[model samples]
Structures are given as structure tokens and as C-alpha cells.
Target: METRELRYFVAVAEELHFGRAAQRLGIAQPPLSRAIQQLERRLGVKLLERTNRTVTLTEAGSVLLREGRAALDAVDAAERRTRRAALAATGQPGLVLVTKAGASSELLSKLLDAYAAEPGAVTVDVHLCGIGEQERLLRDGRADVALLHRPFDSTVGFDTEDLRTEGQVAVLPAGHPLARRAGLRMDDVTALPDLPLPRWPGPDGTYPDGPGPQVRDHTQLLQLVGLGRAAAVLPDSCRAHLNADLAAVPVLDAPTVTTVIAWPPHSRSRALAGLVRAATLL
Candidate 1:
């Protein structure tokens, strides 16, 4: 199917209402409906179930929606990468590296220093972003490489090198009784009735239903912990950055976090290769 038709169907599938999807696409409702119908005919499947007052995706529609989003993202990445290539051909060229803010601080610094010492090293722009934002940035070509922490970040569809693995710690209010403990299990922190764990945004940029305050980054979550409003479980390295108001205890049962340097599988840039090499060496 053509990109335009895929886009239209995706919009409709997501919004579940032709009127809203048409408005989102900045078009009239009738042509949008016609496009969906034509696409369904061409694909020989019922994409949507429409009623007088509601709209819903058919089994086929759900699969198309998932696949279409990936296809569109690939197209967008290709266009952006091509434009960047042209710019590199005629203008100052650089690399963009993205990672979650307040993560991998010491490792990132050492990696940067190591890469800078290499001969013919290009300027590397570092982007510190909110939770669940780095993967999307890398996927859409807005960033060249990323420092992804897994089980938190997915490394699918990319080439990655394992950097290091560390255990997790529970960050809590310093004055809380639990903060004085030698170590805690996952239940000790997760089931805290008073200091509910903070909810982080998912890949879809929506927070899961929870009782905790929605947080966007490590800094924000720490501030909340300091204020006795919430708690967080993060990589053990975070303990080094805790202040007087916040305390960290080893979460013995939490899964280990693995930091990986990731780039698109198709990348062949010498500078990117050098950066990844430096990271692995670190």
C-alpha cells in the first residue's frame, strides 16, 4: 500500500473515529472515509467495524496499524538521514548522541574523553532527554547513537555493544525509616503505602495507571523522593548523586541494568564506529 493510504488508515485506527482522524490529518471527513474504504478493498480485508455511534479495528486492522507505524517511522528516518547526508557533503558535519538524563554520567564522560583523543574526531553533540525518549530519537534519525539501558530500553533493530552491568537501588526519602536499612527487597519499596513508587512514561509516552506521581526524568523523580512524595528504583550508580534529603538502599531483588551503546544496523560512518569502539573500550 502507498504511504499516504497507510498514514490515513493508521490515523483512523488510532483515533477510532473517522471524523477525529480526518480533523487530525487536516482534511474533510468524506475523502478520508473514501481512502480507508479503497485501502480495505485493495488489501481484501475488513480493516474496521463501523457502527452508528462507534468505530473499532478488526483483527487485520490491528496488525496493519502496528506494521504501518514502523513503516512510516522508517520512511521518516530515511528522509532525515538523506538530508543530513547532503548537509555533511556541503557543511559542517557532526554526530548526535542521546541518552536518558541523569544516567551513565561517569561512563559518558569517560567515553567522550576517550573519543575526543582519537585522530580526526568530529564534533559530538550529546542530548540528555527524558525517560523513554532516547529510543524514539535514535529510531527517527534525530540522534545518531544512543546509550540504552535494558530491560528499560529495547535494543531491537539496532547494532549494540554491551558496556557494563550494575545492580539497582531504591531511592527514598532520607528521613523515612526504610532509608536506614542496610538493604531492601523489591517488595519493601514497591509496596510502600505512604511513599508510592513514581510512574514513568512508557514508549507510547503515556504513564501506566498507578497511584504514584508521574515523572519524566531521574532528576524529577529524585526531587519527589526528597520531598517525601514518591520513591524510585534506579541503577546503583544513582547512589553517587543522592543528596542529604534522599537516600539509596540496595534493592537486592531488582534486575540488573545493562548499559549498551546502540546505533542503526545500517550505519557505516567512521566517526560513529570510533565512538562505539571507545565506548566498548571504556
Candidate 2:
């Protein structure tokens, strides 16, 4: 019911282990367990199922986890917006724009130049983040806007405008058999027994179960591909950075990636509006 209770519930629900959740929350395990028990009692439902060796979420817990996460995000957004407002009242420099690192370099350069040329434009602070992080930065007011690639990044809670769309390419080691082809389909790349698709970390920083190596960003993924450890389906723009050791072949059947300018739905800053306008014009 309260923010503290929700925070505790989320931490425990995510970890599924009271001791680890307590450690993450910087509190003792018993207290964390008690808080969850109290929460369950107040809600009149079992949120977690616990035994000697394992802990798992109940159906109610699964529902609560999803709703509670959104509630917490709202709370965080409120606090962050208030702080940003206070800072702006004191004439803080400008808005922050976040984008995934090593993505859309050419488009970003053009967007920045266009926005800067506009009259009354404020100083823009660009924050380069890792994959799957742009949404959090926007939701929590750490960023005013983001350039997100659709199908890869979720745009569920934000307003967005399409900037560009391009097909995907499979980045493979130069000497790999598939790399010699002029173009290929998704099956050609995904079926490679030796070079599995790299698994990217979720927002929680845990890598999904897979045979391929886990990678955090484009640089790491490219390096892995060059070493023949992994293959990646990436935006076509990524070919600009590939070295001779790597080769990119068009993945004819892969879904096209659209780069969009996204922002929190409730944002009201004129500077943010101006930036969006400039970006759309590009």
C-alpha cells in the first residue's frame, strides 16, 4: 500500500530470495521477511511460496509485481520531475537526451546540429546509455528525450515520432562461411551452430539463458563476432563501425528497425518540445 511496502515487495519479488533482496535493500533479512509477511497479510493473499530450498511467486505475486513496478515508476517520476522543476527554477543549463551507445551516430549528429541551429535552443546534455536503459532514464526524469530503436526498445509509456527505418544486417566474422554471401535470411544466421546469437542483459543486469556469450553493448558484440564467438543481428548503421575482421550481410527476412525520438508523455518543457520539433524535421 505504501511506497516502502511496494519497494520491499518489488525487491523480494525480483530476487525471489529474502536474503538477497534484503542485501539489495541494505536491510537485514528478517526485517525484509517480516515486511513481506505484513504486506501479504494486509492484502489477504499469498504473494510468495517459500520452502527450505526455493522461493517462488504466486499468481497474485506475479500480478502485484507488474502493477507494483509501474506504481514505483510513477512515484519515482513524480519525485524526479519535482526536483527537475526546482533546478530549472534556478536556471539549470538544459534538458538531457539519452540514447543507446554506439547507435544512430549519423542520425544523432544531424539531429543535434539541426536542434542547435534553432532559435532559443537551450544547451543539450547528451547521455549515452546501454541497451534497454533509455526507457528507465526517460521514465525517472534522468532524461528529457531518447532516440530508441523499435522492436529492440519498448515505447509503451512514452510519446514517440519516427525518425528513420532501416533493415537489419547479420554481423559475422569475416572468414565465416555465411559472411561470403551477398545477402541472407534470418535462418541462415540463427542456424549457425558455432556462432550463436549473443544474449543481451535484461534491465535487471541478468543475462538470459542461452548458448551464446552475453554482451552488454555493440562494441562487445562486435568484438565477440570478430572472434567467432557470436553473431549479431544489428541495425544497418552498425556496419559503419565494423572493421575488416567483421562482415555484415543483409538479413532479408529480419524485421526492420525504426529509430524514433521518444519522450515521457507528460513532459511540458518548451525546450523539450523545440528539440522534438527539430528532430522530427530532420
Candidate maximizing TM-score: 1
Clash pairs for candidate 1: none
Q: 117-233 in candidate 1: lDDT tens per residue?
A: 998788999999999899999999999999999999999999999999999999998889998999999999988999999889988889999899999999988999998899899
Candidate 1 ranges with C-alpha deviation above 4 Å: none
lDDT of 2 by residue, 9-96 (tens): 9999999888899999999998888999999999999999999989999999999999999999889989988898788779884889
Global lDDT for candidate 1? 0.93
RMSD of each: 1.4, 2.7
For residue 211, model 1's alpha carbon misses the true position, in angstroms, by 1.6
Number of backbone collisions per candidate: 0, 0
